[model samples]
Target: MSSGPSSYKIFDVTLKESVAMTPSLQHCVFYSEDVANMARHAPDQRIKVVLPLAGGEPPCLVDNGGWYPAWLALPAERRPPMRTYTLRNVRPAQGELDIDFVRNGDNGPASRWVNHARIGDRLQLIAPNAAFDGNGSGFEWLPPDGVRQVLLVADETALPAALSILESLSAQASPPQVQAFFEVPLCTDVQALDHYTFAKIHWLPREEQPHQPYGQSLLAALQTRLQIPDDAPRTQDEAAQGILRPELEQMWESAAPAHSAFYGWIACESSGVKALRRYLIHSCGLQRETLSLMAYWCHSR
Candidate 1:
C-alpha cells in the first residue's frame, strides 16, 4: 500500500445523517465547516474516505490545525482501510457532501461502517485541493462538443455518479437527450432525480430475476433501445484511426475526432463494462472518442 504525503490536508467531518434510499441503499451525508472550498470539485468526481479501523488511534491535527486522517496517521503496517466514493451532491453553502453506499450485508468494510454510521460520528475526507492540482481526484464524464444525445448505463455501485452526471447535464441551458439505464437489486432502489427533464430513465431490478448476472439487464436494455448496425466494422484500422492504445488514458488523449451526434458512457462490474465497450465500438459503431467506459468494481475481485 502507498501512503499519501504527511503534508496532505485532511478535512474533519461529522456525520449529518444516514438516510435509507432503499432497503439496501443508504445516502450518507458528512459536513465540515471548512469545506466551502469543495465547490471547486467537478460534478461526479470522487473523494478518498479514510475511516478509522476498530481500536485504531483517533484522528489528530497537524501544526496548521487541519485534521489529519486517522488511517493515514497510523504506521504503514497498521493503517486502516480506505475507499473511494463518488461525490453524489455538494452543498457548499452548508459545507456538506453526500455519498451513497450500497450495503451488502457487511461483505465490505466500507459498507459495514456506513451501515451503522450515526449522526455526529467523526470521519475524515481527503479531497482535491482548491487549485485543481490534478492529483487525488478522479473524474471521467467528458462529453466533447456537438454531442446532442447520450446513453448512460450503470449498476447500483455507479448509480450515484450516473445520477450526478445527469444532474450536471440537466443544468445545462440546452441539455442533450439522455437515455439512462440503471440496474439495482430492488425496484425501490430507484429514487427520484430532480431537474432531469431531458432524460429518459429506465430502472431494472435484478432481484426480480435471480439468475441474471450484474450488467446483463442494462445490456439487454441497451440492445433493445439502440439500433446497432449488423454490418458495423469490428475494429478500426490503425493507420486510418490513428495509433490505437489499450488504455483509456491513451485513447482519451488521442486527437481522434468526435462522433457526430451520440455519446455513450458505461460503468459497472468489470466483465460487463468490457463487454459493453466491445459492443458499443464494434456493433453500435460509436467512435472511441465519443464513449467513456469504466469498470467501477469487480464481482470476483
Candidate 2:
C-alpha cells in the first residue's frame, strides 16, 4: 500500500490470448516475466490497468509504489487512463493472469481498449508483489469468521469478482450458504461458472423487463429473497443522479461485521449501492459492519 517490499509493483504484460466468453465479456490471458511474483491473496483482488496512449504505445509508468504520484506528475497528454478491475485467476508458475473485461462499447477507456484489444497487445498491471511478504493491497473479500450465509451481489461490471469469490469459497472445508444475484445485460451474457452445492446463483437478465432501469432486476431479486425491515421504505432506484458520492472513491468500503452471522458483498452502480446501504443498515437492521457495499461504477460522466 506504500513504499515497501510487501506492497505492489507495476508489471509490463502482454496479452497472450483473448477469448469471447460472452458477447459482453472478454477473458484475456496476459503474460509477463515478473507476473510470477504477482500475488492473489483474496478472491476479489483488485488491480489497475493502464491503457495505451492515443497512438497505441505503452503508457509511461513507474514500476514501484510511487507509480500513482509519478503517473499524475506526467503531463496530462502523457497520462494514460488507468482503470480498476478484478483478477479472475492467476497462474504464477505459468507466468499468466486472467482478467474478464466487460465489452461496453466506448463507455470508457478500459472498455474502448478491450473492444479493440488483441493478442500481443501490451499494458501495465499494478498488482501485489508476491516476491516479498504477502500483502492484501487490493484485496477486499473478507467475511466474518464462521459466517453462516453469504450474500453476493453484482452487475455485469463486478461479475468477475463475484465469480472469483464463489470459486474460492467452494475450496473451503465448510463453505457457507451462498445466495448470489448476478444481473447482466441479457441472459446470453450468463456463462457457465463453477461453484459449490451451497451456492445458489440467480442470474437476472435485464432483457426480460426491458422497461426497467439497468439494475432493477438485481434489486428486485434481492428484496424478494431477503427480509426488509418493517420500517424499511419500499425500494427505489438509487443511481446517484444527484451525486452524493463519487463513483471510484466513496464507492468502496470493506470491513466484515464483527458479530453478525450473515455477511454480504454487494457492488453495482453508485446510487444503488448507497440506497442498499441505507436500507440494509437503517431499514433492515443489518449492522453497518455486516457488509461490503461497493459502488463499482457510476452513471455520471
Candidate 3:
C-alpha cells in the first residue's frame, strides 16, 4: 500500500463538537462510522478537507482524477474549496478525528468555515491510505535509534502537529528527554498538556514582546538558552545537565564515546523556519539528518 495522490480516500464526517482551545484557536472533532481505520494514521500527518461550495451538499467526494486537474475541470460555481490541516488526534473505536484551525476571520476559507462551524455540520476529507505508508504518513518525523533527546519548536499554526508528535513520543516504552517551545499570540492561548510528564514545555507569548517580529523571540530564545557554546568543557556532567548540543558535536570529534543523540524538529512561518534551520545546522553543529525543519506557512507580503 503505497500512499500517493492515487491512494487518497474520501470520508464523510459530521461535526461532533467544537471547542475553543484558545481565543483564536478552535478544535473541531468530526465523527464518521465510515472511517473505520482512523487509528492507522501516523502522528504529524495531514488530511485534505473539502468544504461545500455555495449551496452544495456536505461530505461530497471529489473525482479521483487528481486534485488540481479535477478541481480545475469543475464549473466555477460547482467547485469545492479545499485546505490541508494536520490530523490532530484520532480515536478508532469511536470513529472520531480532530483538527485544530486558527480562527483568523475571513482571511482564509478554512478559518471562516471553522469560525462558524456547528455541531452536526457535515464535511468531507481525503486521508492517506495508511495501509501503504503508515510510518511516513503525509508528514515525516523519524528519529534515529540512538536519539535520546528531542527538541521541538513550533508556532500557533504548527502547534497541532507538534503536540501530536509529543504525544506519540511520550507513549514509547522509554520516552526521550523532550524540550518543546511554542509561540502563541496570547498567554490565554496556552493549553495544558499533562499527558507527557517528561516534556518541558515553554510557552512564548507574543504579546509580551510587542516590538519583536514574529519568530524572532523563538529564535533568540533557542540561541541563548538551547544552543551550546562551542568551547564548553567536554564532560558527561555537561550533557547530563541539559547541554546536549555539545554532546552531539562530540559524536564526530575523534570518535570519542558519543552522548545521547540529539534531534530537532521545527515548524513555523517560512522566514523563521529557514533562519532556525540555519542556526541549528551551521551555528549549533547539528547534523542535517537529525533535524526536521518546515515552514508550515509564509507571512503575506
Give all TM-scores, in the order shown. Answer: 0.81, 0.87, 0.81
RMSD of each: 5.3, 5.1, 7.4
lDDT of 1 by residue, 102-215 (tens): 887776667878877778877777665563444543577767667687778888888888988887887799998888889899978877764588988889898877887778
- Which 10-residue span in candidate 3 carries the lowest summed lDDT? 249-258
Flag the better candidate by TM-score, 2 or 3. Answer: 2
User: What tens digits encode model 2's per-residue C-alpha lDDT throughout 122-142?
Assistant: 899888778666446677788
Question: Candidate order by lDDT, highest to lowest?
Answer: 2, 3, 1
Clashes per model (N, Cα, C within 3 A): 0, 2, 1
Once fitted onto the true fold, the runs of candidate 3 whose alpha carbons sit more than 4 angstroms away are 1-6, 38-40, 54-59, 65-69, 130-136, 227-260
Off by over 4 Å in 2: 1-6, 132-135, 193-195, 227-250
lDDT of 3: 0.73
For residue 242, model 3's alpha carbon misses the true position, in angstroms, by 30
- The local lDDT score (0 to 100) that residue 274 gets in candidate 2 is 72
Model 1: per-residue Cα lDDT at residue 176 = 82
